[model samples]
Target: MNHRSLFRRLLLAAAAALPFALSVGDAAAQAALPSDRVLRVVPHADLRTLDPVAVSVTITRMHGLMIYETLFAWDSQLRPQPQMVESTTTSSDGLTWRFTLREGLRFHDGQPVTTRDVIASLRRWMARDVVGNHLGARVTALEATDARSFEMRLSRPHGFVTYALGSAVGQIPAIMRAEDAETDPSRPITTTIGSGPFRFNRDLWLSGQRVVYDRNPDYVPRREPADGLAGGRVVRVDRVEWQIMPDAATAAAALQTGEIDIWEQPALDLVPVLSRRRDIQVDRLNTISTQAMLRPNSLFPPFNDPRARLALAYATDQAEAMAGGWGDERWWRRCEAYFVCGAPFGTEAGAEGYARPNLDRARELLREAGYNGERIVFITSTDIAPIGRMAEVAAASLRRIGMNIDLQVNDWGTVITRQPRRDPPDQGGWNLFVTFASGPTMQHPLTNIGTNMACDGRNWSGWPCDEEAERLRNAVLDAPEGPERIRLLDALHRRLAETQPYRVLGQVDQPYARRSSVRGMLNAPVMVFWNIEKSAR
Candidate 1:
């Protein structure tokens, strides 16, 4: 078959298998509608896990925001603002800090929000999140002074404590009930009770098929205007339902037929088709753009060698990958810099080495590294549009460099489950996978989960260990918010180029579609479901 024919076949197969991929029931569930006040959305992924604190997936974070509250949140300007906290005071020595909870806060279970709950939630979050862990290491004590007040006694001064707690980047510090927060951070919390604007309808959640949320009438929202992940979380709608439609074509058709009000991340190939519809409104969801990535496992052989990693990196063609993943070059840009282009630390300073593909160099490196004919397990989730295409592009690039590939296809949830396995490739472990993240997350060292060099084999999916990079990341955090911080971040980027833990497959602008009647969408870094209202046709 020709390349175009193959591409069409792949796209069609993905679409045909999607509607039934994660379904346990018949089409009757898709036809079920609660009421006119219900807002139906087709999310990028099905809600696989309910524990937002345990995992940092985009869909889980959205669900967390719907049910859980945070102490602080980021505004549109990226400034940290108080959300659950009514006031905070810091001592001159910076070693002591105090926070008072806002009045009239009540969890879905009717329990008043308390300082003990906040302390437990922070402890649970600090155990998992990188930023939280760093901050936790500096703290001498975390104590609750009263029913609504808490204090933190640190060993030294820390400037980014508030930002770390308020950040929505990865595994946000979502506040939960004290009992739920006391659960082990390594395990998922089954309970979903919080003081957010919306309450999770656990009785109606159908795992990988559908999830529902109802407006919390008793929950109190901030009086301030909504901005990004901060300010008021007013709920104008009575209900929000997320229906899992993995097929791009199916989701676009649903939007056109008015079966769904919003499609969070539409396939790039079908954007034009959706845009031509009069009732559909396609808008750029994330202005920072999405950074495509090729992650390789450093725990196993073949990829365990930096030379082997460099071989694959040399074989990577950002333009080819972007074209295959997101057709129409206008929708994507070739960003070779690992720190993302247009950010403060984003520069071409030391990225001249990774400008273009070098198949000859790749082969030479592979041979020098004594690469045997072992299969490189390349994983792809056919159900996810961009991820499936990206996997194909990366696999093809590696094959061109004379590497053996064992292409594995599965659902997105399965990929997420297997990405963290430490076993060998033969025993359910993964050697490589293709995924993407928001540009804002990768722009800085502290917020960038990809820059983690924990070396403990438990870093981000593809565990990379570079003591130099880790030290530089600390330097970036310690330096004041000025040019010195920028210098430190750039230095870390240069070190990442040498380490080659992962490769940037370019950047793509993701467009979200909603009904024309829906309005007041926020253009924040992460998708905000607040301040959006739907009117009857």
Candidate 2:
């Protein structure tokens, strides 16, 4: 069968199995809650981890925002604004900073938020987050002066201190309780207590089926109007239910039937059908586009050699890959720049030769790298449509260039859990995978986790250790925000192109589908459930 026919058949099969997939208890619970008071959504993926600090997955980050509040948060303009902090002061030398917390902030457990929790949380976050590590390197001391205030003394002046604390990208710097924050950063914490506007109902949580959250009655919102991730987080719905439906057709059917109020990410093929419906509104909530990437394991063979990585880059076609993954020329664009295409630091300095696929050039590079048909294990997620399609495109390109690709398909949760393993590809480890990041996360050298080349294995999953790249990155960070900074960024970009830390496949805009009854939705980089109301159908 053709691709379209096969896809239609799969959707039909999935729609047929929807009844068996949903439990009777789940249906009964939906009946118990009033339609206007409950906001039912089909999330992008199954939430595998609860602790956002431990795993950098997008689902955990969304879950973290529901329960936890950051000291600072990015506004609609991408500028840092105080979220939990009442006031802030900095020393004349710019080395010492002090912050005070707003009163009436209490966790779900009914305990007051204090500076001890903030300090402990920052300490743990600094151990994992890329931006946190940069700030941690310059930290002289971080101490809690009183119950409501804390002080941070740095060795040198850092310009993006608040930005690091308020990052909404991968591995968010969410503040937790002192006891929970004190746990080891390498391990995931089971406790789910925070001071955000919503409270996670862990008791009613059914793995792979449903997750629920109730509005916090005692939680105090900001006085200002709601913006991006900043301003007041006013909760309108009594409860938010996350119905995990792996099949796109099933989720789309539910949304059309008013069984679900929102679908986080509907399959691209089904977008046109859903947009034609009067009750459903398909819109792009995030203003910025997301860049898709192909990350290779730099620690293992084949990919360990820069030539092999470059061969893959030369073989893959960005337009073809993006078309296969995103489906529709209007939503996707080819981006060769590592920092993102239209950003300030975005430059395709050394990416001239690898824009389009050159099979001869790729074969030449593979031969020069002494390749002997090594088994390249490419891991993908079937639950996430774009990722799965991107993997297929990449694998096809690699095979055409005479590479042995072993494509392994699994759920998103299993793929994320397996990405961290450092074993050989023949074992449980992976050789490559396709993923995407928000445009804001990839706009800066410091904020982009993929560019980090920390040799100590403390970096992102694919550990790429390059001392020169690290030096250039540090230079870019220290430089002033002007011509000098841009020059340094270009140098860093050139170096990254040579090393090939990760291949930039393309950029695409993803839209969320919500019913007409769902209102007060905010436009942000990531989805937030607050400030939303569900009208009775």
Segments in model 1 whose C-alpha atoms lie over 4 Å from true places: 1-36, 456-458
Candidate 2, residue 352: CA error in Å? 2.0
Number of residue pairs clashing in candidate 1, backbone atoms closer than 3 angstroms, sequence gap of 3 or more or interchain = 0
lDDT scores of the candidates, listed in order = 0.81, 0.88
Using lDDT as the measure, the top candidate is 2
In Å, residue 263's CA in model 2 sits off its true spot by 1.1
lDDT of 2 by residue, 1-537 (tens): 455664466456555545734561256766777879888889999888999888778899999999999999998777899999999999999999999999999999999999999999999999988888888999989998899999999999998999889999878999999999998898889889999999998877988888889889999999988998999999998889898888777887777767788899888777877787789899997767788999999999888888988887899999989999998888899988888888777888888878888999999988988889989999998788889999999999999999999999998999999888899999999999999988878878888889999787888888888999999999998898899988888899899988889999989888899999889888776899998988899
Which parts of model 2 are misplaced by more than 4 Å? 1-32
The ten-residue window of minimal lDDT in model 1 covers 21-30
**Model 2, TM vs. native:** 0.95
Cα error, candidate 2, residue 327 (Å): 1.3
